[model samples]
Target: MRNARFLWELISYRPASASCRTLFMLACYGERIVFGLAIQAFFNTLPQHTQMTPELFVLFLPWLIAIAVRLIVVNFGTIGAVRFEFSAQALLQHNLFKHILQRPGFQALPDSVGNTISSFRDDTAIVVELLSHLGETCALIIYTSVVFIILLRVNVLITLLVFLPLCCIVVLARQAQKGLEKYRRASRTATSNVTGAIGEIFGAVQAIQVAGAEQHVVAHFHTLNAQRRASMVKDRMLSGALDALFGNVGDIGTALILVLAALSLTAGQIRPGDLVIFLTYLAIVSDFFTDIGSLLAQQTQARISFERMTNVIHGMPDHQLVAHHALHIHDKVNEESAPPAVPQPVVVPLQQLVVRDLCYRYPETGRGIAGINICIQGGTLTVITGRIGAGKTTLLHTLLGLVTADAGEITWNERPVADAAAFFIPQRSAYTAQVPHLFSDTLRENILLGLPEHEHTNDLSTAIHTAVLDHDIAALEHGLDTRIGVRGVKLSGGQIQRVAAARMLVRQPALIVCDDLSSALDIETEQLLWDRLRTSRTQTCIAISHRRSVLQRADQIIVLKQGQVEAAGSLEQLLTTSQEMQRIWQGSE
Candidate 1:
């Protein structure tokens, strides 16, 4: 009884679909009651010479009716509950995904993508097992208990004798649960490690191949798999031991009960029919104890899976700020209209960006830039240059309010952008990612991304020309209407870069931030792109680049070293005055 209470507490603690759970529990009890009564009726009806009264007939009829009703109800209820669980899993997966994409480039990564996929596919499936298996376990327990109660009424002494051994087995089984749970938890961790390692290897496949480290990676993967397998083996061994121990003890108890019955029958103390019924009930009682062991093991497994899922759901960074701002955007746009049916913005933009003593730390690693300050004036092409991993990417992220700056106040114009302002083009830009995620989508529709039914006339021809994509696109059978394949794989690297550039250019945002995107282009192409970019009016551009050709066009060149600014000046000034710049130029060229 205490074990049952604990199980119920576990279920209720993290209840999924309360109404469904309640119905499932009720259905379980009904099933057990119906089955117990049916078994009892079969015993009573045997040996036709025994007196069969009207009350017994009434009892027998109801038991048959109840079992039939329970079968239908339980089957339908389980199906509905499972369907609901799957639907909820799908919704959660979708929301987690969309949330990550909305994050700034700083927080985006290859690992986050894999984690989301695993959570949806692997994690959710485990949770479903918890629901279905746990439900069935509860039903089995109730059915077994009902039979045991009937056995007790038939012969109190024999009933107590059987239950005493069953009680000992239950106590021993519960003791084994703690060890099983530990192994189960280890198994889960090992599995996660294997998954995480595989995700990392796949994500960095290019780097691994370049470094010629396939053997090393495979060896590491094997070790992770070995650890996971070892944990599973141990868990299974412990579970098997519990099962064997319980089965043996129950067998002995059954033998003892049978001997006592035979002795009683020999002495003419109990009828043959009654002794036969006692043995049948004894079997049911033994099977129930075994089921209880199965239930406990399953519950432990569910607990492990639930704990893993809960960690992820709770580990995600808060989306509250984004939600608030999205609401703010709607509010501001709507306030200008009569009746105020839409949301209104309470803040306006002056368009200058100022960073005062900015600092940023990677959330998990606690390693990043600190004590940085810069001002980005409107209407100039500002370039940030740095050695690899020198916090160039971090700075761009800091400006966009992506990674939370540890100690910095970034204000737009004079007002802080705890409101709204900039659009950041990450280091990889839209070129490498699924942005403007091409569909069977028209070029116009893809670019506009559902702006409005009336707002569908945005032509990319001029922007395409500016981005040097005119010639390439014109060769296509449908020109701008040509379908770009998934991730734009059908396009060359340069062509995809140009299309992405064109997409960003067409937006004409107040601030355009680019990161290391010009590294791939030839000198002439880079120069041509810059000439076109120079024509934009009243928009600030900040680009991170290593190429001298790209840097020549910058109004201000900020050089970073070891997460600090080595110098900030024009290209000519940097060449003459910055030692790090001189070294980099001499070495690279």
Candidate 2:
């Protein structure tokens, strides 16, 4: 049922195109029936007239006209089909990617990034191509029905026998369903693995080179390709075998019709003209049945694609893949454009953000934060300090709703934050990761991202200043316009961190969250970063930092140990009262 609904969604995505293409296809096939009738009429009159006559010309003229008219309809249908295919493909890809962005940040993709890309690229096209077949599929069904009725008039028994192959082909397709799906799934998985490995290898090129593991990486890559090649051959071989099987079934059905026709002729119930028409149209009917068989084969594979795509959106309903939204196909593409955001019930200024009895545990390792409670006053710097595996990052992730807490309550300025994921966003709060993501675009564009020019220019200067990026920008060849290589690989580690901080600052978010924001920076730069930020009395921050310099400046510190808060107090108080704090502080020194 979902399969049918999914196809219909794609077909009806562009209603005018669907309707026009259907009508055009019908007229195109209708021409074939007219041609068959003309030829039959010529055969019927041969006994009375040996040569060409006005009657014969009259018989042939409409077929000629139908041929010309079909040319127009077919050309129109082809144009519409091409356009519809592209448009529908774009819509599905857009929706799939959009939903992925809406999901929580901590949820990993269903598979590797490469597998997800395969679903986004290949699966979408497969589904849209199914819609592309609708016009021809529908036309064949109607054409075959009309052809069947004409044959019934000539000899009903043979007509009934013709349908026997159609039934057999359906059964054959049903029987092969499991094999088709299995091979297709294997082939797609193999492709994803290969693609994912290539991406990972490329991203870690420096590491591989430094480790002198290039030969090993190449050997591993070759292994993945070999697996892909084997799976692809199996997948293709099975598809080809099915195609040949369908064609043979149609041929076998035609053979039965031939014997029936001969028997009918001997009984003197069928005329020569009728036999000519039946023999002429038998191939067409056979081909239609073959098409029906192939369509069934496609459905099996399409189901896998549908499953993969829905799985990408965190296992949302399949209908949402084709969910209606403005595509803006005619407009310049906007990164932040909608499908509009879900409206938040309340948007308030940050004063005090509170978390009470928050709990979460990593399912795989069972070493995450539990019963965590914390508070943040607006315009103050609150630092979370802990050793590795202490659930420091996990607690921050819970506060941002990156991971769903097993149990917790969070409030902003005394108002309950029903959805931490949605509530903690730009202009209200912004979180920067330990390793920030930067694009291969101009340094300026990386900071602005999708922000408008007018809006960004207004705040870009202040943001650059506060992030301590002004000096770096001035030293660069193009300053703000410098094109940073992929992931800002062209910049030093510290520059990337500063750029990320500038990006967050440009939004002027009420609350700034960072997970070890200074991990890549030197002492001087790190101090400058904190000093600049501290000057802003209205800026509130929650960051994970074990660096003694950063820890010493915190207004309040939360010390975590084994997923629980070990202590919370000023740095001086913790230095004397908490041994864990002392150890962490010494380790940093």
Candidate 3:
């Protein structure tokens, strides 16, 4: 019932479109009644009216007019269906993306990438496919009722005989429901498994080769394909059988009506023209049963699609999947006109930021930051340094709300932050992760990803210079316009880091957070990077680094060990007082 309601909500998403589609489609189907009556009249008057008689011509005229009318009705009905399909599809995709973006940045998605793709592409489409048929189904219902009344007036026994097939069709459809739903679900699952395995194979090609598992991988792929083939065959076979069953049942009913009409004709109980109309209307009525069967089958598949979509979204309410939202189908404004101005974000200067009792633990490993504390005043460099696996990256991720904290309090200039992920955005706090992500686009676009080039043109230049990427990019043939291939794989490791740093710096956030920004740079480049950053005196910075140049220049240095802050002070003080700090400092040498 809940799934049915969701489908109804989608169909009626744009009421205006739904109404036009139904009205126009009815006009199209209503033509069938006009033509049916005209044919019956012509046959009945054949003995009374000679060739080219005015009476028969009168009936012929309406049939001709209906032909022209059908042309227009089908055209408009097609328009309505097309518009509704696109709008409903846009709404579902919009909601899916919105829900996906709302999750914590550090949390992995519930489904594999291929499965999510299938949910977005296949699952959403099947639901809308059911919606597309609804207009015709409504028109057919009205057409069938009118035909039923016409036939009942002609002969009571024949009317029941003609519609008996409809009952059989309904029973068969009910019987096929379990198989239809089960096979559809199995087919979709098998398809998802095959697609997921393909994605995994692509991502792990190097590992597979290193492990000499090529044959094993091939065997696994073959297995998945076999499963998909078997499931699809069953699904299609069952669906086809239902269609054939409806057709054969309708044919048997038609034969019975013809035989009964012949007997009545022999007894002079019915006119020959009455049999013509019966056959004519019987074809249309037969269509109603076939369509009803198809609709019931599609309903079963649509329910399965909805269930899969809900799973992709981590069990979000089914209504959310089809929730009504604005679908900007077309641009209302003229292209020659100026585009609307974008509003800039508000920026507040940071006096100091404080964190107390911040804690988070990995459920799998139970080794994450715990009860961490820190304070940063404006215009100072605060470097967080630690050895490998010391929770340096985790601390940064936890505080920034990329990962949810188990317990914490964050104060930004005396204001408490309720949501770190939402609050720590561009112009407030900009962070560069240790392993940065880049798209297969030009370096210029990647650097100004969030910041508009025209608005932040100067910020672009300053950030490039600050991150020491200006020299590297200038060395390239196309400079910043050069396309960095997928994930910046074409660039050296150091260049990728610098491009990411420039991306973070361009926003000119009040607080700068970086995780091992210098991990890939050489000593001289690292030195130059710090020198450029120190030149900016008003912004606070928290970074992960173990370089002596960074250690010596730090306004405060924090050393982490085993998920806790072991010591925190200036480089000189930490070297003198803390054994853990001394070991870390010596280890750097």
TM-score of each: 0.77, 0.92, 0.90
lDDT per residue for candidate 1 within 189-302, as digits (tens), equals 777788788778865676799999999999999998999999999988998898897677657777887888888778877656566666655555676678678777877876
Tens-digit lDDT string for candidate 3 (1-589):
9887887788778877766667777887778888888888888888786566676778778888888888887788778778887888788888888888876677736778888888888878887788877777888899989988988888888889768757866786888889888998999999999999998897667679999999999999999999999999999999999989777766776798889999999998888778988888878688888888888988988888877778766746767887887666765757455465555457788888899999999988999999899898988999998889999999999999988899989998899999998888888889988889898999999999845688889999999999998778889989989999877867988999999999999988889999888989999998999899889888889999887888888999988999999999999999999998898889888
Name the lDDT of candidate 2. 0.85
Specify the highest-TM-score model's number. Answer: 2
Residue clash pairs of candidate 1: 331-343, 331-344, 331-345, 332-343, 332-344, 332-345, 352-413, 359-406
lDDT for 468 (candidate 3): 96
Ranking by TM-score: 2, 3, 1
TM-score of 3: 0.90
Tens-place lDDT per residue, model 2, 343-366, is 434446679988999998887888
RMSD of 2: 2.9
Pick the winner on TM-score between candidates 2 and 3: 2
Which model is ahead, 1 or 3, in terms of lDDT? 3
Candidate 1 residues lying further than 4 Å off, grouped into runs, are 1-60, 87-116, 200-220, 243-256, 267-287, 313-350, 363-367, 419-463, 472-492, 506-508, 582-588
Error (Å) of candidate 2 at residue 335 is: 14
